[model samples]
Target: MRFEGKVALVTAAAQGIGAAVARRLADEGASVVVTDLQEDKLGEVAAGIGARALPLRVDVTSRDDVDAAVAAAVERFGRLDVVVNNAGGCIVQSAPEDTTDDDWRAQLDLTLVGASRCIQAALPELVKNRGNVVTISSVNGLAAFGNIEYSAAKAGQIAMTVNYAARYGSLGVRFNVVAPGTIRTPNWDNQPDTLERLSKMYPLGRIGEPEDIAAAVAFLASDDAAWITGHTLPVEGGVLTGPTVLNPALSKKEYPGH
Candidate 1:
């Protein structure tokens, strides 16, 4: 068990990648604290993950809420071994011109600021245990993928990870970011042919599952990656590697070596 006798706290863990992460950690023997604004859904996920899971209602946008949640996890688990800052999303989809000040701030507050708040609140405990932090970034963060505000916030997280790692490495704490591509979650639900279209963009020819992200999160949070820190691991099915498209005309053209 990679996480035996360890404690992991995950935010936005009611569903999607967060839930999968919580489950994966718990299955590997960590006592996981799963939190989200959706208390009912959070409870369901916790229950499914078994006795090793604790579900808490947490609104990451609030500093007080983040602090309280961290305190609660420490109180129950005795210590914090891992902190996964996963409470983030593209709350508003719009162009820079159309994006309201509120829209921009909301993305920052929820994704970038929220993760920072959680890290700040958990730093004392993390330092004590020499633990790790795994933040969920996105491929959009690494490029201009349309969702302007969200992409910017995600990019901010990558910066945060590197700077934090540099600041806290001597203290025996590690920080890393996982940049996922188009994950198949409820966010894509009812969007006609959305998954199919997005799948074509990845070299793998399929969209990612929540569990795929979970597996990467687990590895980063474990001792296997002990020497790894201040890094952004792209679990985006090679979308950021190169073009997935193939044209018959382009393929037919070959060098003299052929």
Candidate 2:
């Protein structure tokens, strides 16, 4: 029960990595406020967590909604100690060169500025409680993974975390980021073949699960990482080590010396 009396607010908690993070925190004794635009799914998540979870509908793009959720969290939980900015996703559909100004604005607004709004509204309480933030970025941000807009926004998250950690370290607060590789979520329910093909690209022989990301978030949010801050921990399955297929012999489990 690392979070015995701590309170956490997780955005985009209806499902996927968000829901997993909320449950992980609650399981460790934190009162969690789970926010998402999907009211019904959010309710289910809260229900599973029982009395420790509060479900709220929040559109992170809207400042009013973000502010209201923060206010509601303090009111319901009495205090807030952690903020999980798990709200962003890739919403752009246009080709990179064909992408319009509106596409760029929409992507950045939801994925980047949305995180800023949450931090702004919750800063007061966080400062008072010596809280921290764990943003859900992506391995796409650290490398060129095709989706240019999404990768840019994810990279911005890492940058934001570093800057926040620097400015707030004196105030007893910290900020960190978890950049995940492809995970099995509802977003890819229809892409089983894609996941299978992608799995081969990972050194671990499988893509990540939401629980994998949650474990990292739990560690970063807890006192276990007290001395850690301003870091981007990539939860990718060694894909960041470069393509293993380039040298097929390197992909084998045994070496000639062994």
Candidate 3:
């Protein structure tokens, strides 16, 4: 129970990685405030976690909603020790040349500024508790994975973490990022063939699970990483080493006879 008395607020906690992170924290004894726009799904997540969880409908793009959620978390949990900024996702669908100014704004607003709002809202409580933040970035931010707008927004998150870590270290707070490779989330549920093909690109022989990311968040949020900060831990199953698709024969597991 690393988080025995700690309280955590996780954004986008309706499902996938957010849900997993909330559950992981609750399992380790943290009172979790789960926020997402999906009210029904958020309720289910809170129910599963029982009395330790509080579900709230929060639209990260709205400052009012973000502020309200933070206030609600403190009111119910009495304190906030960790903020998991998992509220962002890729929303742009146009090609780079076709992407508009609105597309850029929308992507950055949710993925980048949205995180900032949460951190801002909880800064007071976090400072009082010597708390930390773990942002869910993406391997796309670290490398060229095709979605230009999304990748840029995700990269902004990494940059934000580094700066926040530097600015707040003296205040007893820390910030870090988890850049994950393609995970088995609902976002990819309709793209089974795409996921299967992408799995081969990973050196680990499979894509990541939400729990895999949750474990990293737990460590970064807990005292175990007391000396760690301003770092981007890529929990990407070695995909960053290089995608196996580039040279199939090089992967013995994927091409045994080669």
TM-score of each: 0.94, 0.96, 0.95
Which candidate order results from sorting by lDDT in descending order? 3, 2, 1
Better of 1 and 2 by lDDT: 2
lDDT of each: 0.92, 0.94, 0.94
| Number of backbone collisions per candidate | 0, 0, 0
Q: Which of the two, 1 or 2, has more TM-score?
A: 2
- Highest TM-score among the candidates is held by which one? 2
Order the candidates by TM-score, highest first: 2, 3, 1
Worst 10 residues of 1 by lDDT: 247-256
lDDT of 1 by residue, 78-178 (tens): 89999999999989867689999999889999999999999999999999999999999999889878888889999999999999999999999999999
Candidate 3's C-alpha runs over 4 A off are 245-258
In model 3, the worst 10-residue window by lDDT is 243-252
